[model samples]
Structure formats: C-alpha cells, structure tokens
Target chain A: MILERQLRDELKQYASSQQCPPDMHARLRQQMEQAMGKGAFRPARFRRGVMAAAISAALLLPAAAFAGNPMLADRIYGSFEQLKKKMTAVTMEQYAALAGKLSGAQAQLGEKEYARYEALLKQYVRAAYEYGNGKGYIDFDALPAEKRAEMKQLLRELQPYFDRLNGERSAKEVLSPEAFDRYIEAQMTYQTVLAQAGIEAGQRFTSQDIPAHLRDRFEKAEAVIREVSRATDPRR
Target chain B: MNEWEVQQLLKRLAAGDLAAFDRIYEMTFQDVYRTLSLLLVNRGDIEDVMNEVYVGMWLSLPRYDPGRPFRYWLHGLIVRKAQDWRRKAWRRLRLLKRANWAKGTDGWTDDSVLAAETRQEVLTLVRRLPYKLRVVIILRYYHDYTLEEMAELLQIPLGTVKSRHHHALKKLRRQLEERPQGKVASTDDLGTTTT
Candidate 1:
C-alpha cells in the first residue's frame, strides 16, 4: 500500500526538480575517485634499535679503510656514541624547555644557534605528536608577540630537523639509513614549499578565530591546564 | 520488488553509482517537495530549500544504514530542513510585523478556471484557522499523510492527531458553510472547546 498516498503524489511532483546537476555530480565523483586512488599516506621512516645502529654505522662509516684510519674509526665511533646518548635521554619536558629558550633568544642568536634551536623545536613537535597529539590548553596572549613571530620563523628553519627526525625514526624500524635520510630531505623540501605558501605553526590562532561551538571546549581545556599548573606551583 | 532488492539498490547508490542515486531521488522527490512547500509558501524559497534537502540527502547517503527504511530517513531530513526554514522565516516575519502595522495572511490563490475559485476560497478559510489546525489539514488533506503516520512523523500522540484533525476540519467546514456560495453545512462547528 502507498504511504501518505494523497500528499505523496503532490510532494513527489515538487521534489522531482531537486536532482543533482549532472556536471556537479561528475566533478564531485572525479575528485573523490582521485583522492581514493592516491591512497593512504605512508607512515614516516624512523631509525631505532640494534638494526638502526648498524644502518647508522653503514652510513657514517666508510667501507674502505686506510693504513692510518684507526683514528678515523675512533672519531666515527665517538660521534655515534654521542648520538645514542642524545636520542636516549630526550623527553617531552626537555623539548618544551628548549622551545622556551629558542623563543627567548631567537632575536639575538646567530644562524648556527638558530639551526640548533630549530632542531630543538623539531624535538618538541615530535614529542607533542607522540604525546596524544599535544592537544593541551594554549594561551595566545601569554605568548609574547616577539616569541610568536620567532616561532613562525622557526617553523621554516625546523623543517630539515623534522625531516631528519622522521627519517631516523622510520629508519630505526627497517634498518635503512640512506632511505631515512632521503625521506627526511624530501620532507624538509616539502615543508619549505609549504612555508612559501605562508602557512606557519600557531598562526592565526586566537580566541576570536575559534568557531563558537569549539570555544567552550578550548576554554575548558585552558581552565583545566591552569588549575594543574597552579597546583604544581604553590607560589602562583 | 522485494525489500532485499531495495537494500541492494541503496548499497549501490551509496557506492557512488549515479543511476541508483537518480532512481532513489525520483522515487522520493515529490513527497519531499510537498513537505517543504507546505512549510515555505514562496515557490522560489521552496526550490532553494528543495535543492538543499536533496544535496543533504546525497551527502548523507554514505552514512545510511541498510536496515532502516530509506524513505523514512529521507522524509526525516525533509522535515528537519523545513523546520529550520520555518524558524528563519518566523524570525524575519516577526521583524516585518514589528515594522508594519498591517497583519499577514496565509494560503495561495492562483486565478483560473473550473473549481479554482472554490478551492482557493476553501484554502483561504483553512489558512485563517489556528496554525496548529492549519498544519493538520495541510498534512492530512494536501499531503495525504494518514493520521497515524502524521502523528508519528510529527512526534505527537495519535489521539492529539485525531483531535487536531477533527478541530481543523470542523473550523474549515464552519468557514465554508458561512461563505457566499455555501451549500451543505457541517453540523460540527468549531464552537466547542478542546481540552
């Protein structure tokens, strides 16, 4: 039996004109298909474990040795030892502290320190991503304008560092140091292109920029973080 | 013909098959449009809202669960969009009423031949009644949704639907009987109070 039979015909006649335009459907379908064909993004390459160390050795140490190359071997081993020490002790808190330092001294620092500071910034980013997307409370006004600008500039400078870190992590999984380096280099260049497009870390982020529905969530997160921080620091 | 075939069609449509989408659209478009037209009086507004309704349907098709009745889900979307339109329209009308001293009227009248005059007179009489009654008459007679289905779709009690149906028809009949070309009179006038 027909449902709502009387109004049915009239309503049907009225709704018939609402068909999707043929051109629009074709365009939408084409775009979706292209996205599907592109497929999933491959996970980033990283270097770790014993296999990672072996690959690092393969990359840092030359295959052929000269008669007096014993000193060179020792130097290479020393660098590896230092690298292992650096990677093992790195923590999220350390990255945040480094970020604090980088932002404070950004204006007065030279290019070499800037590069090192940018590497520290990359470490913070990796830690943030690792720590459940680092979706904590952020105070835009609390961050000094100069610090904000420095962070924006630092995003571009930190691209190579991010690439190297991602590569090292990926390489650690499969013992491919050369592959890791290539991946890192590609990412740095890609990020450079993105920087040219003028997208920056923490840019255009303000209370006004947030959508109405999400503002409540942001406020709650901020309040929660503030409470935690206050509890930790009795002087505050 | 069977429910299984309908389910298959819906799945294919969800998979981006254009032909299935069109079939589903054709099958459901009329009722959807009528529902919208009732909520919005302007033909142009109906056309715009209708497009939004179908576009919404298309966007939501992927999320359609095969077990649910597609028509019910589609109609639910139409009702939601129509309500949204009404809310916006009510805001605009309230502003307009404040600006102008004159009162607003309802229903349509397209001057033509045959029973056009009679239908227009009756429709105008129906529109002059309380909005709740008017909605019942429009949904019941104009759209032909059953009292039970109307109650279900509108989320009102079946008894309330019956009462509204009686009240609306009673008022329409009273108005029609009092008109100049009055013929048969309805004994049940809207003089009595409803609980």
Candidate 2:
C-alpha cells in the first residue's frame, strides 16, 4: 500500500509540475497548417513508387486520352513533374494519412509479394516515363502493345489497392458530394477507354454490365457507391 | 474544456478553422506531453509524436465519434503514436548499426538536459523497463487506467493486459528491492541497461 501511494505521488507530482515547452504549440500549429495545405504524401522511404502511382491515378480514366504527346521519356518525366505540381494543391498529409491505411494491407503481404509490388511500381514509372515523352508531353496509348500489357498487368495488381483507396476524397475543394459522384460517373466511359489499352474491365466492366451469374459483384457496385458517400459526407 | 465545448471546437475544426485547431492543441498539450514523456525516452521523439497526434487529431476529427469520451479517443491516438515511435526506433537502430555509429552509441544522452529532465531514479527505472512492461506501468499507474480499459485501448486481449501488468509490477518491485534500502542509488546499482 505504501509503495502504491509513493508511486502515485511521484507520478502525479511529475505530471502536475511539468508543462510542455511553450514553443511546441506554435511550431506544431504551423506544421498542421502546412500539412493541411499539401497533398497526401507516402513515407519518404516509399516516395519512390508514389510518383508513378499518382501519375497512373490520373490514368484512372483512359490511356488513349493521354496517348501520343510524343511517347518520349523526357516528355513523360516533365508531364509527371507537372502532375506532381498540380497534386501539391491538395493536402498531402491527408493523402498520406489515407495511404497509410494501405500500409496495413502491405504489411500483411509476404516479403516476396511486397518485393514484387515494388518491382511493379518501378516498371510503371518506367513505362510512364518512356511512353510518350519524346520532347514535352505524355501519350499513354502511343506506347507499344507489350508496354500496354505491362500497364494492364500493373493495373490488375493495383486493382485491389485502387479498390481499397477508391474512397478518394477529390483534391478539388469545391466539389460537392453529388457533383463528386457525377465526376467519377463521367469517368466510367473513360474507364472503358483505358480498358481499351488492356483492362478487360475497361471494355464491359461497368456497374450496369455485371453478369447475372456473378452474384458477389453486386457488392462491388454497392461498395463503390457507399465509399463515395462516405468520402463526401464528413462523419464529424 | 467541457464535453460540450470540446464538441463545439471539434465541429469548428472539421469545418477548417485553424483557430479551433490551436484551441484544441492548447487544451490537450499537457496531458498529451506527460503521457508521451512516460512512454518515450527521447525528447525529440516526444515532440515528433506529439506533432503526429495533434496533426492526426486534426485530420481525424471527421471520424471522431462524439458519443464516446473524447479523452479516451485522444489517448488512443497518443498510445498509437508512441507505438509508431517504437517501430521507428527499431528502424533507426538498424540504420545506426549499418552506418557504424562511431562517435556516439545507443546509451548516448546529453547529461545536462536528459539528466535534468529525468533526475528521478524511479522514473529512470521505469523508462528502462522493456517496452511492453513499461507501457503497462505507465498506463496503469501514471494514467490510472483499469486493466480492462488498457485492453480495450490497446486492442489486446484482457488476459494479455493482465499478465503484462502483473509482470510489470513484479519487475518494478524487484528493481526496488535491489536498491540498498532508503539510500540513493549509485549509477552502477541501476546499471546501464534494462531487460
């Protein structure tokens, strides 16, 4: 009993006597504001694949639209640089917070699987850089068919990641939930267009196209709608 | 802040009010700092993790459920950030090993600063305890949380939390026993390492 009382007294006394250094509040407040202003960031260690992942994120629609800016690696790199610039307008920390969720899924994978994911990330960046960057633009469709295959395979692997992260809060601050739904809905046609590059989903995988036999797929349709709802509606 | 007031602040925070975020940080800093000080050894780490908790609090406000106690929710974030620090420390240790840390070592501390902050032998002993045991002690005695509550907050089995608490108390008791009764402990007595 004495021991307990003494321990409690020491701890309580310490807590009551100590105050956080005064600078921390102002410094942290600045950081929070800065975080709020930036786009989502992955851990610096994982920032390598992020450029490719985000570049392809705009590729969520159609490859054809992005095709033929001359398919030069330099141009692709420049365009990638531009996309990264535009992405900065949104809050990176929030984006990183969301990406952090993917780490849980990543952690669950075996070492070899994670290595493969890393490899695919590199491949996607290469293909994007080399696709259509002769001088100064991007053209995803202009890439050779085999390169397109790489993107498709990459897409197949990334589908689950995209599904997990499909609860995308648009970086655009002004987009309303209803308007947001319309935004993604407009991409359905573009999804098919990108599918033309190679995703079988691009061809006929629209929500309306679910076959009668695959009962589980109705869940996909349901989940997509719900995620969008959750994204736009702030639960706080 | 009162429950209603905190809720109002949270609402303003979620709506993008920077002043509300500052208000929330000021309201919670001391408790958060004290809790973190118990869990971490490095002051720099405490600052980093506190930044995370507050920044995370701002980012996470939308998901905060008003129905539940706000302090518990905040503590949950605090504990998780501490765990993140633990994970990062392992990574840092690995880097230190790879880089061949020559000038300084893991036991390195600036005595003028660190010793002043952790002058108490009891606190030093507690900090030196293994991470699992240390956390249980901090949560139990410092925070005055029930084992059941610790289980829920830590998302561990109740039995696991109970065992950890029991083992932590036993270890602390043993440490206390080792000191020559009622005399100040020489640095050699406590030793340089913890199990």
Candidate 3:
C-alpha cells in the first residue's frame, strides 16, 4: 500500500509539473488540416544537370512522322548521346565556377574563426550534396502525419543556427580585397573536402555531412526539395 | 461517452462514421492533448504534434484490436506519437548532451511537487530516467495500469513491461527513502486499468 501510494504521488507530481497549456491543440489541428488539404509538399529542385539533360533532349526531339515531318530517328539517339557528352562538360564547368566562388568566399576567415567556419561549410556542403542525390530531401507535408510533425518539430529546433550562418555569410561578403582572397582559399579548401568526401560535382547536394546543430534546416530543406522533385521529376 | 459507449462509437468510427470520429475526438482530445503536452514539453511544438497524433489515430483506427479497451489503444497511440516526435527532433541525442531539461520547474496552479506532496521526491527522481523508461513509469503509476495491461497497450511483451515496472518502481522507492519528506497518501482511488 505504501509503495502504491508513493508511486501515485510521484506520478501526479510529474503530471502537474508538466501541465501542457491548453490552446495548443486547436493550432496543431489546423496545421494538420491545412497540410492535408494541400496534399504532399515537395522540396525545392536544384537539379541543374537533370534539367540540362531534359532541356537538351526536348530541343532535339521532333523526330516522329508528324505533319511537319521533322528530324529523322536514325540520328536522334546518336544526337542524344552526343548531347549527353556535351552536357557533362558544361556541368563540370559550372561546378568549377561555383566552387571558385565559394573558395573565394572562404579565404577571408581569420585563423581563430577558421575551424568553426570550415566545420559549418563542410557540414552544409555534405548536407546539400546528399540532399540532391539521396532520400534526404523529403516532403514532410506528404510524410505520414506523425512523421511530418516530428520532422517539423526537428526543423523548428534547428532554425536559429541556419539563420545565423546565412547572416554571417552575407556579412562576410563586404570584406576588403586581400581579406576576400584569403576567403577564397578557405572556400577552395571546402570544395576539396567535398571532393575528398566523394560527393561528385554537377549533382544535387546531399545531407550526409550535416552537423547536428544544422540538421533541422537540412531536414526541412530536404523534405521540401523531395516534394518538388517528386512533383517535377519526369520519371515520377 | 462512457467507456462502453465510447467503444461502440469507435466501432462506428472504424466502419467509416465521420460523425463518430468527431465524437471520439470530443471524448478524448483533452486526455490526449494533456498527455502530449507533458511528454513533448515544448509549447511551440505541441499543437502540430497533437494534430498529427489524432490523424495517426484516425488512420490506424481500422486496425485497433477490438478485444482491448479503447483507452488502452489510445494510450498506445499517444505514446507512439510522442516517441515519433522525439526521434525526428533528434532529441535523444540532445538529451544525452544536456542534463534533463524537464527538471526543477516551480510552476503555479498545477505545482507538481505541491500537488503530489507525498510522491514529490520519487516523481522528481523518475523524471531523470531515459525516455523509454520514463514512459513506462508514467503509464504505470500516473495513468495507473497493471504490468500486463501496459504491455498490451504498448504492444510490447508482457515480460518487458513487468521488467520496466519493477525497475522503475524500485528506483522510485530508493529515491523516496533517501529523501523521506513527502507523505504517502492512499492511491486506491487512482485510475488503474485493472479496476
């Protein structure tokens, strides 16, 4: 009897100390309903390579026996193959340009600030690369209701760090010429890290390298990207 | 609705009675919401979680075993949903980093220690256990259920529930013995599934 009483008292105290404020329920229900009404949300698409592939494919593909009797099919597949080769070259060039830009930005960080900045950059790059290729990009809105809420909550917790990082990045853009040159070296170091990590250029970014603090942003972004990819992917 | 009537309404809900769904919501929203708020512990995240829990319950209603009590099933759903929330937030990782966040509160109105004066020390102690163990303790004592009933409700093996119950209670007793301040009121009227 004493044991039971002790247990109850303990349990009740736990409950009382944790009384959830009312009114939270109505808001959650509304969000859920609104999300449901919208159907599944997709993530943003950053698939330049795929988009390039599709664009070139469309431009060269009027080969059927239409009333206009366009380009013939004997050379269509060959042309697509040639386009693929050219597309690969163009993608590499674009990646180099972007990496150069990022490298230029990185060289300006002071020695003291280098560690944290490098860590954050590596984390974001890893996350972005993984998000582009893997299931990391998700549509939380389209996820099972429970999973969606869970991800959203996770995203909520991680938003502050991401906002800070973005603000810091913009602020660094105003550095003097010499400072900007050093920043480029740091950016190049980041790109090297990405390459060493086996994330190929010209593909969508992934989330594998994301640090814990920024995981929520990566998760939210991934979910949104996946939703967009699903909505836009021709194969889907 | 009373327990039996709620069961009948759930049966209708299972068979596609949208009105019955609304009835069930009215019947249990308070209970579910209150529990979710406590488990989640964040005011900002609670509402979305509550709606998700309800939506999950709605989707899973068809599979709810009729042999079990509806409240037990509902309890299971709530626990699962709370776990789901914890997982996505990676709160489990964060929990290990920080000393438990849910501790040392001195809130008004529902002042936990004051309300359960006798159990206060033990309650405070149990709050420090890991999440899974904490759930077992909460379902066992605060909500009041037998070891077997808890297992069924949580859809785990009976032996697992028994082990957790035994371990949690033993920990509580040890903690309370060390403190020895609060009184122990009879909990015979406490809500228990066995009753």
* Leading candidate by DockQ: 2
DockQ of each: 0.02, 0.13, 0.09
What TM-score against the true chain A does chain A of each candidate get?
0.22, 0.30, 0.23
Docking class of 3: incorrect
Error of 3 at A193 (Å): 29
Which ranges in model 1 have alpha carbons more than 4 Å from their true place? A1-236, B1-3, B59-68, B90-119, B126-135, B189-195
TM-score of chain B of each: 0.64, 0.75, 0.67
Cα-based TM-score, every candidate: 0.37, 0.48, 0.46
lDDT of 2 by residue, A46-73 (tens): 1011112343332221111112222122
lDDT of 3 by residue, B109-177 (tens): 122443376435554555455567778877766787777788888889987776776665566555555
Positional deviation of residue B77's Cα in model 3 after best superposition, in angstroms: 0.8
Worst 10 residues of 1 chain A by lDDT: A44-53
Off by over 4 Å in 3: A1-3, A13-22, A28-118, A121-236, B1-4, B11-19, B37-45, B91-119, B177-195
lDDT of 1 at A145: 72
For residues B3-31, could you state the per-residue lDDT of candidate 2 as single tens digits? 99999999987776789888888789999
